[model samples]
Structure formats: C-alpha cells, structure tokens
Target: MPPETGLRIPQDNRFVLSNARVPTELVADPPPGATRDAEGALLLDLLVQNGRIAALFPAGMAPETACRVDLEGRHLWPAFIDMHTHLDCGHAIPRVRPDGTIHGGFSLTAEDWPRWTDEDLDLRMEFGIRCAHAHGVSALRSHVDSETLAYSQRHWRALDRLRAKWAGKVDLQGVTICAMEAWIGPEARALADLAADMGGILGGVTDTLDRGENGTYDALGQALDRLFALAGERELDVDLHVDQTEDLSAFTIPEIAKARLRSGFKGRVVLGHCVNLSLMPPEVIDRTLALAREADLAFVSMPTPMMYLMDRKPGRTPRWRGVTTANEIRAAGLPLAIGGDNCRDAWFAYGDHDMLDTLKQAIRVFQADEPLTGSLAMASRVPADLIGRPDLGRIGADLPANLVIFQARSLNVILARDQADRIVLKNGRQVTDPLPQHHELEAALGLLDTAS
Candidate 1:
C-alpha cells in the first residue's frame, strides 16, 4: 500500500507544493538555482495562485504561503494525454474475438455492432470517459467505427454528447475509423463533411482487408489520394490505423506517406499501429521512415493491444512482440506517441483507461526508461501536441495547475507498481471522484457473471 499524505488545499486556491519531483525536461523556464536529482528529476517548490501555476522555485525556497502541501519528494507530472482509443466499442467484454486475431476481432465486433443502441453507446462511452478522468487523463482521441454512414452518425452524436458533458474535465476528440476503400466514393466526401461538422478528425484503416479488395498499390494510392483530398477540403486532420499486421507484405505505411507527399495535404497526419514496421527489413524500414519524415507523419503506438493480438498461433509459442519500431520512429525526429488503444473490447480484454499505466507499459515494451528525463512526455506533452492542446501537457508558469502527484519519489518506483493512490489536481483543486463501479455497467453489458 502507498503511504498517505494530507492532500487538503486552502479555499482561496493559493498554495505551495514543496519537494515535488518532476521530470526535468517538463519544467519550462525553470528559476535560477533549480537543481535536478541523479535521475534528471527537478526537486522544486511549485507555487499555485488563483488556479494557475505562478512560478517554480528551488526546493525549500518557496515563500511562506497561506497553504502548503508537502509532497515528501513524490513524483509529479502533468495530466496524461491518450492520443488513440476506441471508446465507442469499449467495455464490450465477453463479446471478444474468438481466435484472438485481428480478423477475428473485426468479425466479432461487427457481429456485435447491431446490438449497440444509442443508450448502450452513451453508457459505455461515459463509463470510459469517467475512467479516463479518474486516472488523471486530461485529453484523449477515440477512433469510432464508421463502416456505414448511419452507424457513423449515431456514434458521432453519442460522442458529441459526451464531449459536451465532459467539456472541461476531459478534452475529448473523435475520429472516424473506416476502410480505405470506403473513402473512394461520394460517401467518402459525405463522411468527411460529417466529421468536420462534428469537429472530429478523418481516419481509416490501411490493412490487408482493404488492399486485398483494392487489388493493387495503384488503387490503394488512388484511395489515399481521395482520402487526403477530402480531408484537405474539410480542413480536418487525418489519423489512420496503418499496417497493423505481421505479414511482411503488409507494408502500407510507405504508400500512405507517398500519398501524403503527392497530395500535398498540409493538415496533420497521425498513423497508429504500424506494427509491420517492426518485421520489415532494414532497407524497407529505412525507406518507410524517410518517406514518413518527408511527409511529416506522426505516429502513435498501441503496444498493449498489439502485443496481445499480433503473432498468435494455436499450440505454438508466440515469437514476436507485436509493436512498431518505436525507437527508430522517435530517432527519425517524428512526433511519436504511445496510446492505450482498446479496453475491455473485442480487440483487447484489458486496460482501465489509465494513461500512466499505458506509459509504464510503453516503457517496459520499448525500454524507454533508460534516460527517464523525457519519457513521460510521450503520454503527456507529445500526445497533447498531437491533439492540438499544448496547454495540458507541460508544467510551466501561467499554465493551469492541472497535475497528478504520486506517492513514489522516482520513475523506478512508479514503474514497479500501479500508482493507484495518485492525487489529481485540476485547476489547483483536488478531484475526489471515485472510480465508477463495475455493477453500474453490469445490466447494460450483461456483465453480471464477468463482474464476479
């Protein structure tokens, strides 16, 4: 169990948080004499005034204030940003994929989609959003299944309601996830317009599912050209599920990059789950990354779900880690983020919408903790920037005092266990909301037995 600290704050929203261990890189314009510990963490006293960060002073140098909370060297970070998620299909546990493969998951989810009423979607999406909020997630982008216009409208409306309800708490953004071929016709333009009306991003999947039917790379390029043109016309950003397969032939990331360069689409392009890049040979990987750099492509890796769903075989040991080339993507100077892709859905059966947990999993999977100075930014600043919300990710003066403070003093201690006892401060006030009960969802989800 984690030790308890008295987390009370004053009524006037003026306080000093002393001895907080924050990542050095996250601190912007630090005061003179601000010092870092051995692990490149700044030990500082942060002053909060009128629900904003007034300044950061060196440890023990803060002026006497009306209220003071001693963190006792606990780790503090900006609230997390989950750049990729599937909230519309979230919490459909026990309706999961039969064979634990990508195709199986798709089929299973499609079979279950007919049962998704508006109320059902609202309950599940609200639950997911509340889970994310309780876990210190300040912003998230969810990919809604948009195989048909009717289905897409329903989900987008449901998301819009939740977006309004959770307006200040969780910054919610939605993306339409469809097949690449779906973007080739007049309906594609309609879908893009719908996304713009809903203030959402345009997105699709570029996998063997579409490539097999589209017949050739030329057709795929034509489809991508149309997709980018529609997005450019609507002034919407593009987020895609690209190359999420183990087959060496399933290399669509490069083509997508080429299409981006060819179309001259100036909007932001984010590619998710380029799992095949990990299996590609060095030359192919180099070429794909070069194209990505030239196209200004950003990436978000869904490590947990990819690890669970990729490279599975019956009665055989799994050989590969189903993740993308995270290190190389980061090395190429591209904006790479880590996302918690699915939760209790057909695609994956685990996850609590916790971005800290996602970051910890990413660190273990990608070996991202060696330097420890900037790794936390992947879940915070990087995704926040990708989502166009720069104010939510870093700790700086004049920013809102939205932060999560943990009992652990160092990153290693945080990685050793789930920091469930974290204190979430929004606008310099504590959020004491408890996690939603599983029983609340039991009736709607038929989860009575699963809850047991």
Candidate 2:
C-alpha cells in the first residue's frame, strides 16, 4: 500500500520501534492510573507486542521473535487527545458571511445547521476524524449542538454509529451542547437521560451573565443548578462553554465554581474558553481561581477559534488578544488544556483538526514557548486525563502502543517544518487511508481540485 493509504507496517504483533527517543520523564507526570516500567523512565528501543508496549531494549538489539523497523532517531510523542470540539457540525464553508466576530460566527453556524444531511454529516465527520488521526489524535470528545431534545438524541445516535465504525482506530465521545436553560424541566431531564443512555456527556454554555445585576445572577444560578442537577441525576460528566467572551458582564466561571461548590457535585467538569479571565479584575481573578480549585475544574482553551471570533470591532485594531489567561492558570496548577475547536466550520473557517496546529497556536497566544513548561500537555497528557483515559497518553511498558513518529530530529525542527512526513500508529498498526466515503464531501467542497 502507498504511504498515503497509511504508513506501511511489517507483519506480526511484536515489533521493535528502532532508535526512537523515549522520554526520561513526561513533560508533566502521567495522570492518575497510567502504567509505567519499574524504573519508570528510559531511552531505548521500544518493544511492542500484541499491541501494547512490551519492554524497552538498548538500540540495535532486535529480539529474534519480533519485527524491526528503524525510526532513525526521529522524535516520538504520544498520540494526541482532543478534549473538546464541534465535529458533529463537521466541515463546511459557511453560507452566511463571516464578519470576523463571535456573533457573526454564531449566525453562520445557525444558518448552516439545518442544511446538514445525515450522509453529508457522516462524510464530513469522517474527513475531519481522518485528518485528526493523520495528525496523531487517537481520542477526542466532540460536542454536538443540541438545538432541541429530539435533534440532540438523533445526533447522539449518529455519533454512536460513527463510534462503532471507528472502534479501536479512534475513540470518539459525544457531548450534547445547549444553552444552560435547556437543562431545566422534565423535558430537559429526559433529554439529559437520553444523552447518557446514548453514551454522551452533558454540556451547556453559560456565556451570558451579568456580574452585579441581581436578576441576572438569579437567572444564571437557577440555570446552572438545573444543569448540575441533570448531570448528577444522569451520573454523567459535564463539559461547559463558560465565559467565552471578554465582556466583564459575560464572566460565568466564578458562578460555575460556586455552583459546583453549592451542589457538592463530585462528577468531573471540563470548562472551555474562559476568555474573560484574561481581562477580569485582579481580585475577581483570584477569587475565581480559588473557587475553581475548590471545585476541581479543568479548563480547555480553544485559542485558534477564540483568537478568530474575539476582539473584532470593524475599523479598530483590537488592543486585547483573544485568549484565556493561560499563564496564570498554569501557574496556579490548574489542569488546563488546549483543543482543536470548530474546524473549517462556521465558528472558525480554518483548521484540519490537527492538535499540533492547535498546540503551536497556543504556544504563540499563551507565551508558553519555554523548555519544560508542559505546553504539549495541552494536547497530550492533560487532555488524556480530562477525557478519563489515563492509559492513552503515556509511552511505557504495558501502555497501548499508540504512538506518533515525527520525521524530525528535534521538537524545534518539527515546529518549524511542515510536518507532512509523519506517521500515526494505532495499536501497532499504521493508519494509511482516509475514509472512502469522504470522497463525496471532498468533491462537493472542491477539495479534490489539483489546481487552485
């Protein structure tokens, strides 16, 4: 098979990844439940057997029973896990105008949603997943817009089919996304129950709230209470879009933290965006962080989309950068991750579902371009934990042999290069082909064109 079909692999389950650079320590410690060798560190040839890392041997030594393929000193990183995305919406050139603002993006998305067909959605989603897989993401959590309870149920069913089809190759989890108000009442409770029944997580957006207004606080608190109640009732985890705007009135992180504390909800909560944190008053920021710590919340920052949708006022050069206060979050020891959100959709016009692309953008936006700063944790280790897969992101004995082999000598060189010469391994096999069904989407979108 051609390399594009997937990287060529030798026969047999046992193989030696020759001359690979095994890390002495993860940039961050492995999340709770990760498996490691007795020494827990090494630099040697990785021995993979029956789709799990078997052992590490010194370079140039090949076991008689195993196949050997040389990495030739290329850098190796664990496969990526995207903690948040909207791939159920999939990739489309939005019909409505993109005015380069958040509202404009939302308007475009709304206009585009009703036009989606089952076939079209499946094709586009397959394309997006293949793109992410090619870039070395093996697990992902994709948010499906729950416009209504019925639509959300149908979306989860579709995701279930996709999940079965891509089993072992990629793990896809669905998140039912809606406004906080949608989580209220009997009908909403049924919806949340259906989502859990269909193996989907609970999700809601709390991006609208007034800081000091009594009525606003009451309304917001009621909505959050209902949301958390549904989550607790369904015994489902929650991923929220909170404070995605920089407007001071839109700050909802503090309220969410307080809600967690009040409800005493012990389920895992993942928050996305929190862009207002970058612009909040110092005292408010401190309070919010302290509350988040108490609530044990994790944050997923979508810098690429945030940078695109935020701070856009026509004819004005924006003074504020459109990203979260990442430095402060990291300094406070929060489990902060960066994700590839809204790829080629109305919310963002670009992206191929590449975690490295997102991580690179995060480095620039958050000024995390320092050695041993755990920047890669945004896509790899931290997200693995957020998605509750402590077993996936670490490279060690007894770990599943999912790995990304970059054909670069160093991290800096990989960052500087185009990174086309890379291969993804899933359970010791190379992924060579995109889905055959993706052809229709490609043709319709003019992506098959060889000439510009």
Deviating ranges (above 4 Å) for candidate 2? 1-8, 23-42, 57-65, 94-97, 209-216, 434-452
- For every model shown, what is its TM-score relative to the native structure? 0.95, 0.90
Best by TM-score: 1
> Which run of 10 residues does model 1 get worst, by summed lDDT?
1-10
Model 2, residue 323: distance off in Å is: 0.9
What TM-score does candidate 1 reach?
0.95
Worst 10 residues of 2 by lDDT: 27-36
Clashes of each: 0, 4
lDDT of 2 by residue, 178-251 (tens): 87767664568777888888888888888754444454577678878888888898788889998877678777
